[model samples]
Target: LFGYVLILVLVTFDYKELAPLGYILYGIVILLLIYTGLFVHTIAGTQRWINLGFFHLQPSEPAKLAVVIVLASYYSNHDTEDGYRLRDIIRPAILTAVPFVLIMMQPDLGTALMLGILFVSMTLFVKLRWSTISILGTVAMGGAFIGWKFLLKDYQRRRIETFLNPEGDPMNHGYQIMQSKIAVGSGQVFGKGFLEGTQGHLHFLPERHTDFAFSVWAEEWGFVGSVFFLGCYFFLLLWGINIAMTARDKFGVLLAFGLVMLIFWQAVINLFMIMGFLPVVGIPLPLFSYGGSSLLTTLISIGILMNIRMRRYQIKT
Candidate 1:
């Protein structure tokens, strides 16, 4: 209901109004992330949220929006017909890296990855010289290697190691993935019916209401229903992509596409993690997962998409 209300409220505003405030908003989120990381009490082994009495607020979630808007604001105003020089992206990279570093300090790997991906996705849309793309790609690969080898914490590395060999640690790191697979396999075709899933109802699936919400959904809905749900997600992505393509200005295009990618990768990673194809990262599935911060950010992104769609007739170009 709050999500719906957010969409209704934001859709009525002009997206263009946000252009000037992008950097300011981005800076504000950065400060919030720093405060959360340093001062907020740790919960479940991480200090990722601020205690707001009624509800804990996760600053990193909204940082996704801040980064997207600020990047779009920069790109829309200054663009080149020919491919950009490699040096041109430094500003945007720095803009993205600030929040990335802050969130990483919170030790929230999932949101940090999302920010990095958001930057890369938005950059890809811009026409870049082949040499520049090659250099950046190589740099990205090297960064990943260094991140895995030195930056990842002991438990984080164990998660990936366990993903490779689940049988090695069935009772510890590997437990969740193994159980997730069983639940998925148990939901053969038509499912066991709503609220009747043994895995979820029996409380056998850990984090069933949050990170593994899809597992609960699949265990109850079966393969057919799972397919239907996934199809809807696919349609939403395609629809948002179409909106990005048809957007009147470059900012709208970037904003719409960036927001969609933000939601897209989260869903993809969550589903793959649940199915044992990837290591479990605590990324929540948009709308489907029970998280106040994620749901609010997702709805705001949807609202921005609607804002872009409604104002398409007012082409800036």
Candidate 2:
């Protein structure tokens, strides 16, 4: 809802026009969605999508909801012999792996990492034993390390290394982070004023309309506006948590919690990355970024939350 509205606003004000390439963009998004499920075998390198000249769509985005629904449905029907058996864990793990493997192929390390976090959070909520958690954690960490060393592309490694020492590569990989910091720092307490940001207007900050949208806000609105934006997110998070707490079933609660965590954690990680507090992970600020795919996915996720909330109050009996 918010995404569609924001896009309309952008188009209305002529702030950003999409009509010229809208058809191509929509065509690609549709193709990517179809390919992700039907042609998983043919998908190479990244599990994201097949670019069709116009736009690139990520099926993994919706796959997140599918995994949640499938996992929730399974748990809703099944009973554990002792806490949660190995099979119980394996089923959900397999469900998560299908999409995780696909998205990782896109080489979208950020979304893949988010999916990993979602899996861990949901599994923990399922009441896995400490021993199992420990074993899984160790294995996951080791696999990640191996992936970093062997599977990750050269540029990806540079992102991590650059995050650690951004100043070392001011003109290359670090340029985005450095410019982001300058934009944020320049805002100080108040801000430079809307559409008046030198960094943003001058194109010094890369992805200004997308991943680094927050920097545009910070550079213009300053600390006050930034806090306001965060407050809205805070409201959304708290409301989602409240919905989970009052949910009639464990499945509803876990699904709501998992979704909330997904959004909240993404926001935190993205903001931290843009602020130079963490490595640049290419995670976009939800609702505020310009990508149509991301915007639509986030809105649909919120719609799912609304559906859960509305239905949660009705007694099945």
Candidate 3:
């Protein structure tokens, strides 16, 4: 309901109004994230949210949106006919790194990873030169090596280990993925029916109401339901692409596409993580997963997407 309300409210304005305020939003979110990381008490083992009485404001979620807007503003302002070189992306990379490191310090790998993905998606959308791509590819390979060797905590390392061999630690680190896979397989062709899946209702699956929400739904609704739900997500991405292609200006195009990639990667990572194909990184499935912060950010992205589509007829300023 709140998501719907936000959408209704935002589409009333010209999305162009948001362009000028991009850096302002980015700065505010960065400060909020720093406060949350430094002072907020950890809930469920991570200090990713600020306690605001009735609402736990997770600034990292909105940081995703902020990065999209700010990067769009930067890219649109300095768009080149050819592509971005290594030096060309330094500012955006630095803009992204500040939030990425803050979120990483929160040990919230999921959101940090999301910020990195958003940066890559938007930069690629702008078309990087071949020489720049080669440099980035090498740097990414080196970064991955260093991250695994030096930066990953013990539990973070365990996730990757569990992904490869869940049975090795069936009663511990591997438990959630094992149960999630079972829930999905149990659904089969026709599922166990509404409110009937034992894995979820019986507490066999951990985090069923939050990270594993899709598992519960899949278990109850079966293959047909899963396909239908995924199909809807597929269409949403397509619509976002259509909006970007038809948008009147570069900022709108970048904003719409960046927002779509944000949703796209989250959904893919969550589904794969739950199904045991990828390590569990605590990424909530967009819209499907039960999270106020995640839902709000996603809806805002959708609202902005609609705003861009709605104002397609406006003259470019």
Candidate 4:
């Protein structure tokens, strides 16, 4: 498969060689985001992809990798033992915010939040002072409140509202969450078995094969199977974190950490969305969701992870 080949190629490739081109790739993705907004095909109400004759490419997918490499490269080169000062985070903040703003303009709140979380997650490992962390944390919470009140578009706000009270708009915005909850609960402890889930099989569940893949999966697999799937994800995260801890250089450490959070956070959010605990923000369930861009992005991140793990040792002179 192409995924296997990508991991093979990146594993053998030197990560350092990609280091210098980090900003270049970042810039290219930024351009792609802008181009996508201005000229790419717009479906429904979002402009988030480019038509390439064969397949539509979502710029935000690659933008995730670009942000990781750019931030890792910057952090590895500029790290301090005592951690960063308030003034020290400006450039990295800009690096993250630029894409954050651009992607948000496409109204891709899910990916934008991922970028914001990526920056915060990486900064936590950068050894900042406790006082600084407290101040930043407070500011971040306040900023989130403000963004929710003012910056989020109409539908975005409605999604959050719907999550809070699915009954409020049962026939419209809340339909997905309401149906999802029913399907998940219907499975109870033992599930209804494969191809036997009434909610999904009978079409009561929306987006059954895509955003609601978890709903269908849970309906068929039951509580035990759902727990097993989550256990696998837990191990996957642990594996990436292990690689980050043992990486030979700062770049390798940050790169692996960023990629892990990228997958980890997206999966967490998507899971929460399906359970009606969070708003449906259109985040795919990584490898499980039926999406080309989401699958490819995950594969690329895995490739980078394997690349870091493979080169975690010094070469013999």
On lDDT, the candidate that comes out on top is 3
Segments in model 1 whose C-alpha atoms lie over 4 Å from true places: 315-317
Per-residue alpha-carbon lDDT of candidate 2 for residues 121-172, written as tens digits (9 for 90 to 100): 8777776667787779898999889889876778889999999999999999
Judge candidate 2 at residue 1 and give its lDDT. Answer: 54
lDDT of 2 at 184: 93
Residue pairs with backbone overlap in model 4: none
> Residue-wise lDDT of candidate 1 within 1-317, one digit each (tens)?
87789899988878988888877888889889889877888877888978789777899999999999988998888799888778988899999999888887778888898899999999988888899899999999999999888777788889989999988999999999988988888888988889999988898889999888898888888999999999999999998999999998888999999999998999999999999999987899998999899999999899999999999888464
- Please list the residue runs of candidate 2 whose C-alpha ends up more than 4 Å from where it truly belongs after superposition: 1-56, 79-82
TM-score of 4: 0.95
List where candidate 3 sits over 4 angstroms from the true fold.
none
Give all candidate RMSDs, comma-separated.
1.3, 8.1, 1.1, 1.6
Give TM per candidate. Answer: 0.97, 0.83, 0.97, 0.95
Best by TM-score: 3
Clashes of each: 0, 6, 0, 0
C-alpha RMSD in Å of predicted model 4 compared with the true structure: 1.6
Worst 10 residues of 1 by lDDT: 308-317
- lDDT by residue (1-317, candidate 4, tens digit) is 67668877877878877788888989899999999888866687888978888887888988888988888998889878887887788798899999898888888998888899899998887888887888889989998998898779999999988899999999999999999999999888889999999999999998999899999989998999899999999999999999999888888889999999999998999999999889998888988998788898899899988887888887622
Tell me the deviation in Å of residue 189 in model 4. Answer: 2.4
